[model samples]
Target: MSVLLEFTIRSDQFKLGHVLSGSGDMRFELERIVPTGGHTMPFVWVSTERDPNEDLPRFEANMRESDSVQELLALDRVDDGGLYRIEWEGQPEGLIKGLAEAEATVLEAFGDRNWTFRVRFMDHERLTNFHNYLTDHDISVHIIRTYTFTEEGARRRDFGLTNEQREALVLALQRGYFDTPSEVTLDELAEELGITKQAISDRIRRGNEKMLRPLLLSSAAR
Candidate 1:
């Protein structure tokens, strides 16, 4: 059985986060990570509430001058954001190395001020190793939650969520979107994530349905 772990780390705690600390109001979503010999290349989607035309240049310049960034490439540019491939210097330490050592798969990761990572390990032992590795390296992390992946009958019990859905749901919960009178609005969440209001709305709605279906069905059967 695989275990999923969700945790949070401050921007100042990780090398990649330190390099991007001057990214202004830009929000980053890590699309994928590729390990190459001692180095790691991460494809990230960069977005901002401001105009990308003005922000992108500053972003590119910062990365080029950062000691941590070995190489940078702009893969795609959209209206609001762009995709970038960044190769980091050999990381003998930090979050990337720890994940690699524990054989964890990063399911979703994004942040502006701080980062939240949802990752999976083969089992509880691997998850424990990951925690131990981080502690050994002096990397402090706040674990948000953990759950085991299991199957029942012909159904998949992993909540049946897409990455986008999971992100939306997590952010909503964190921001108190479901609070009485709502502490946050959909538009605000959209702006913070550099996404459109409609997109966020659909994600929350669909995500709710997927999660509720299983629980509601199980209750009725009982």
Candidate 2:
């Protein structure tokens, strides 16, 4: 199952760029960062202030030159927060959100600058015990948004899915009714859908098989 993860990162407190960008006020947190299979994704990283003209040139140069910085993106400042989206490789480091030390440091630094980041990937869950580990520390975290991660499909919706199928798929995906690395139970979803759990399970199984059909066939073709 393809899932979309979007993350909002706050700027580090020690950096001059953070304070200048206005990211210094409200701390940003990682919401989600899923995979994109390297299809040229959209990403955003903002500092503390709005007018970054004075410092953007140097920062952009450094970002482009930095070895650890993969494909980065810039976005326009929108209401509420900075908005930017990036297509990234096999899962950006979503695991870091679960780290107590890292989380603490990021929250502390957010007030110093404007830090905005968003990543798009495929697999939504594979952090091992990372999410739970972070929650164990008594952090107030929540999933702020949901995405289908189907730029291609949406662009060609006429041929992809029937309206009913699309709606079912979106709702199921959002509710985590589909199978995941973590053992997902269909009982609740089935109950809500007014169907038997076994029927729900069958639909999920079929849907997943359909999603992976091309890859499975390609392997056999080879």
Candidate 3:
């Protein structure tokens, strides 16, 4: 059976983490990683609460300084943020490396003060191997949760939702916003959640898509 696993690790301990930690308030989101002959290239999206132009140069310089980073290329600006391509010079570290070695798929990853990763393994043995690899490296790995990858399980496995998204969804459901009669409006849901109506709407829309993609694809095949 396939397994979906979630774990968190501090930023100070890993190479990419070290590179990202230099830019205070900047958040890194891993988009994709491709393993080359003896290296891996990671495409990352970076955003900050402040202006990107104010912090992007410094962040690029930080990436250049890291020995593991062979080359750093600024891909483009994404909305209010920036996208980057890094030529990783050496073997990756932490869970990223472990997952790569095990041939597991990293479904999602995001970072701030700490990074959270969602990884999928083919079976229990592969998952165990990944856990053992982390232990051997003396890297602390906390299992946030684990579940068999199923259509239903996808909805509950976090799906890249922030705490706010989860709360908004739960509150909306409890208040009957999803019902035909619709007991609550977006304004009411936002007021109860203490966020803007637009914010709540975006959260619900994105969260729904993320959780439903798996089921949608499965149904399309049949």
Candidate 4:
């Protein structure tokens, strides 16, 4: 059985996060990681609300000065952000190393200040090993939740919803947010989850769309 883990790590604790501190309000979403020789190269999308033309140069300059970054290549520019590939000077330590050692697959990873990651490990043993590796490295990580997926569970959880979305939807259902009269309000849900009401609302809305889209499409085809 595969185990899915959701955890949070402080920006200063992770190498990439430390390098990206220069990005100001920019957010990074890791596209993929490539292992070369002894180093790992990460391709990430840099997003910011400010003008990319004005910020990109500054961000690049900051990254270049970082000891962890050996080479930075601008891949492409999108409407909201640009993609860049970074080559580390040496082998990455901490989370990346632990993930590689445990052979865990990064499902989702993105953020600034604090990064939240959803990773999948092959089994319970691999998850244990990954945790042990992080502990030995003295990497401080807060695990939000873990789920072991069986075949049936995987099918049920396979809607395009993210972990946050799924959690929001589940809590909403449990608290009668979907009821006609509504026993719970968005504020309550957000408070319970330690997030803003707007965040909770967005998750529920997006989650509903993700879960309903496939079913509605299939039914229409039928």
Q: What's the distance in Å from true for residue 205, model 2?
A: 44
Q: Report RMSD for candidate 3.
A: 4.8
Where model 2 places Cα greater than 4 Å from the true spot, the runs are: 1-32, 38-42, 77-82, 85-91, 94-128, 131-222
Give lDDT: candidate 1, residue 72: 96
Instruction: Summarize candidate 2's per-residue lDDT along 165-197 as a digit string, tens digits.
Output: 354456578876555653345677667777555
Per-residue CA lDDT of model 4 for 108-199, tens digit only, reads 68888999888888999999999899888899999988887664256555784778889999999999999999999998999999976756
User: TM-score, each model?
Assistant: 0.70, 0.29, 0.74, 0.70
Give the candidate number with the greatest TM-score. Answer: 3
Candidate 4: segments with Cα more than 4 A from true spot: 151-222
Please tell me which model should have the higher TM-score, number 3 or number 4. 3
How does model 4 score by TM-score? 0.70
Clashing pairs in 4: none
Least well predicted 10-residue stretch by lDDT in candidate 4: 148-157
Displacement of the residue 144 alpha carbon in candidate 1, Å: 0.9
Alpha-carbon shift of residue 219 in model 2 (angstroms): 44
What is the model-wide C-alpha lDDT for candidate 1?
A: 0.82
Each model's lDDT: 0.82, 0.41, 0.77, 0.82
Q: Determine which window of 10 residues in candidate 1 has minimal summed lDDT.
A: 149-158
Supply candidate 1's per-residue lDDT for 7.
92
lDDT of 3 at 220: 98
